[model samples]
Target: MTERTFDSATSGPIVLGLSLPVGSVRVQVIESLITARVVLHTDDSTGPAADAVNRARSEQNGQVFGIEVPDMPNGVIVRGDRGTVVQSVGNMSFVGGTVRINGRVVSGGMGNMPTVSPIEATVCLPAGSSFGLAGTSADAEVFGYVDRMEFRSVSGDLDADGVRQLTANTTSGDINVGRVTEQITAHSVSGDIEVRLYDGSAATLNTTSGDIEMQATGAASGHVSAHSISGDVRLAGARHLSVSADSVSSRIRR
Candidate 1:
């Protein structure tokens, strides 16, 4: 249960990367003094496997967030370390200007593996930063004004709002977005997609067995293209210009 914070730049665009295996992740954009927070949890306290788990937790704990300078051209990466900090929690870093955040959750066990559910990791980023989020089997929620946003999930529901450009992919989990101002590219396998566009530029939504529903402002002049194999496509209040919808057997309503 150790916590640490890092310092970042002051101004400019920031990129965020987040990865987790099983626990939920919540990200908030605020005009604050900090960049982000990372929490790692494991069964290192009390268990027959406590010693082994504690050794692993100590090695991989604070290694979650890595920063790259101009050499790498503004980047952040999140993934598992050398099998240490897979279950421990609490690591934070602060940076400005093109911030990138990366997180990961791995599976491991000790002799007497504790039956503790992973704690949720909450991150706070600067407002209006470019962001990227990734997760597997853990639900994610993001709120902020992003210049550009990218998200990937597997069987994890995602919710976001106040984004300018969005690229998202999901499998077997729902995606809900609000107030998209520029464009959106979304893909889903068996999860539904719902988006509300205030001033849309373009949208490409694809799903295999999940429904797609989108709404644009009446004054929108953007183009919308949607495809689904066995799911419905519903569009409301979108401009009648340059719109395309396709489905195999489900209904397509505009």
Candidate 2:
């Protein structure tokens, strides 16, 4: 296991990013500090898995901070800057490309080696910070309040709490959020979507074959839309809002 800490007071509003192929990530918001702890969950800690964990690099460009792990020799590129962060991993290959962070080379070339083991990361950021993630089969959990949160995954579940703006996209992974204050947009193919204690003004939740459930609190007075093709749509405590709910071949209950 490896741990790193950063001072959030000097960086203003920090944007933390993580990229992993297969693992679980947990993020928590704190008062004024940032810490990241990573562990490789494998039996062979002295082999390539250990090397991957050792090679995990942390980069920062102004308020943007990120961690990049060369989990796969080929088909994985993780890069970030002050404006945006992009991370991709799988069987696809990008030839003649170099991965860089703030114009510094992280990985110059990709090898034809096998992928590494699963990694578990727990990160702590300050309040009102933003987070971005890109992964495959990496389940994520977020605690406390965040200014903005965005993630994209395949077969990885997301559980979050107290986010101002939330956007998530997943295939076959459930999405659950609590205490949203502003806006939320989520889409899943075969995973359930549930939101509780939502004071948000606008919400757009969609699923192909999964259920959609939402419960509003306080005086949420905007528009809420939920749709599912072959799953149930259940809503509660949303009397003061305009709701547009639909289901193709399933139940819609209010």
Top candidate when judged by lDDT against the true structure: 2
Cα TM-score per model = 0.68, 0.76
Query: lDDT tens digits, residues 1-254, model 1?
Result: 32233333344335655554444667777877355443434333543222222322211223234221110011211122212222323232334422122432222212222333333556666666666666555577887777787878777787887788889998988889987888889999999999976577888999999999998887667688999999999988874647889999999988
Residue 246 lDDT (model 2): 96
Worst 10 residues of 1 by lDDT: 68-77
Collision count of model 2? 0
Candidate 1 displacement at residue 10 in angstroms? 4.8
lDDT of each: 0.62, 0.73
Per-residue lDDT of model 2, residues 32-129, tens digit only: 65443333344335555456666777777777777775654434332211111123433334445864434444464434323344556777777778
RMSD for each model, in Å, please? Answer: 12.3, 9.0
Collision count for each candidate, in order? 25, 0
Q: Candidate 1 at residue 230, lDDT?
A: 99
